[model samples]
Target chain A: AQSVAQPEDQVNVAEGNPLTVKCTYSVSGNPYLFWYVQYPNRGLQFLLKYITGDNLVKGSYGFEAEFNKSQTSFHLKKPSALVSDSALYFCAVRDGKDIFGKGTRLHILP
Target chain B: GAGVSQTPSNKVTEKGKYVELRCDPISGHTALYWYRQSLGQGPEFLIYFQGTGAADDSGLPNDRFFAVRPEGSVSTLKIQRTERGDSAVYLCASSPGVGPLYGYTFGSGTRLTVV
Candidate 1:
């Protein structure tokens, strides 16, 4: 079955430090990868997506993701973290339907 | 509306009761989707509608779960004999189409608590 995997349940990073939330996927055809963030009690907000072009896709709020076809991974990254960036992150892949991975909670410490 | 909208931001219902959660997609969006998100988990696909027809509903767990988008705009997800396991946040999203060009815009969601 087509699926996306977020290996980390929680990731902690000191404010201003670089942060990375890992994700991997298993699908048959060319993958359409996307990243979404959810704040407490709020709906998910789109961050970035990777369809076919460049591997590095930048998105809202200084967020970007690197799509590695060889590794079947689309990891979300940020150059510098902020306390407001702490939220739940989800990695999704579009097969027939949009399949989401177990979310990873990111904590940006002060 | 400016974005997708879901009604009853929170619902606390007794188990075995039936409930309906509503979703109003963004104006002009042709594709609407429903998902369920449990505590500490990501949203799981439940159903998808395209222009008043159910394009895909294979993700719905059982027959008790049904949805309709009669006008291809507003949708209602109906769940019968609700159980404790059904307690989760029901999310509604919409996109221009099912193509890769557009990402989904999700609503705040309706938290259904079955007790």
Candidate 2:
């Protein structure tokens, strides 16, 4: 079965420090990877996606993701963290349908 | 400027009752999708519609759940014999076509509570 995995349940980062939220996926054929962020009581906001051509995909809020074919990882990264960046991060893969990861709660400390 | 719209931002229904959740996708977006998000979990796919046809619905938990998009724009998800296990936030999203990296829009979603 196709699936996406976010091993980290929660990740904490001090303000202005680089942050990384790990994600890995398993799917047949070419993989379509995506990252999304959800705030409390709101719907998910689109972050970034990796389809083809580039391994490094940049997305909203100064966030970027590196898609690794051999490792099957598409980890989300940010050069610097902000308090507002704290939220639930979801990794999704588009197979026949979109399969999402369990989600990772990111906390940015002051 | 209008994003995907889901009606009844919150719904509370008793178990064994019937409930309907509605979604209106963005104008000219031909691919519409429905997902269910449980507490502390990511959204799970429920179904997808391309134009007026259901392209995929393999993720629906059971036969009690159904959806329709006769006009190819506004879709309604109907649940029969709702159970407490059915409680979740039903989310709706749309894109221009199948699996595009861009133009996917999501709605606030309807929080369905089954008592």
Candidate 3:
């Protein structure tokens, strides 16, 4: 069974400060990881994905993720957080069916 | 369509009634997926359609839920004897290909509420 785990339920970060949302996965074969963001009353938007090659993958809206194979982690990161960046973040892994984690609520304090 | 489109932005139905949700995937996308999302939870996969056939449907909760993609471009999710527990946002997404290589383009989703 392919499963993703987001340890933090919520993360609060000060505006302009760096932020990180942790994610880990358990899968049988090669892990294909992805990051998605959902705003209020909106659908999940694709941020970035790690299929192969580069361990550090960059995504939309100044977002990036580091895929650690040994640790089984794909953590979302941003150098400077903005107030508008506050939303629900999801970490997903694809095998046959794409499975998402519970999600972490990111709150950027202004 | 430029992106995935789902009909009925919001729907309210009485318990035991039948309701259907529609999804129009991207024009060239061959893979379509349906998911149900409850409050504060991740999207739960209901089914996946590759072309016109359902490749996987193990995520469907019960027999009351059914889906079809007759033309391979548009898909419909039909629910019978709806219950209050069925209240959640139904999301539709489409990808150009299957598996991990491509990212999906999601629709706004249909908010279904069973009263």
- Tens-place lDDT per residue, model 2, A1-110, is 77899999999999999999999999878888889999877778889999898899999999999999999999999999999999999998887557789999999999
Q: How would the candidate models be sorted by lDDT, starting from the highest?
A: 3, 1, 2
Give one digit per residue, the lDDT tens place, for model 3 in B43-112: 9999999999999999999999999999899999999999999999999999998988888888999999
On residues A77-96, what C-alpha lDDT tens digit does candidate 1 reach at each position?
99999999999999999875
lDDT of 2 by residue, B1-115 (tens): 3889999999999999999999999999989999999988888899999999999999889999999999999999999999999999999998888864553578999999998
iRMS for model 1?
0.9
What is the lDDT of every predicted structure here? Answer: 0.95, 0.91, 0.95
- DockQ score of the complex predicted as candidate 1: 0.81
Best by DockQ: 1
Per-candidate TM-scores read 0.98, 0.97, 0.98
**Which of the two candidates, 2 or 3, achieves a greater DockQ against the reference?**
3
iRMSD per prediction, in order? 0.9, 1.7, 0.9
Report the alpha-carbon TM-score of model 3 versus the true structure.
0.98
Model 3 chain A: worst 10 consecutive residues (lDDT sum): A93-102
- lDDT digits (tens) for residues A24-69 of candidate 3: 9999989999999999878789999999999999999999999998
Predicted complexes: DockQ each = 0.81, 0.66, 0.80
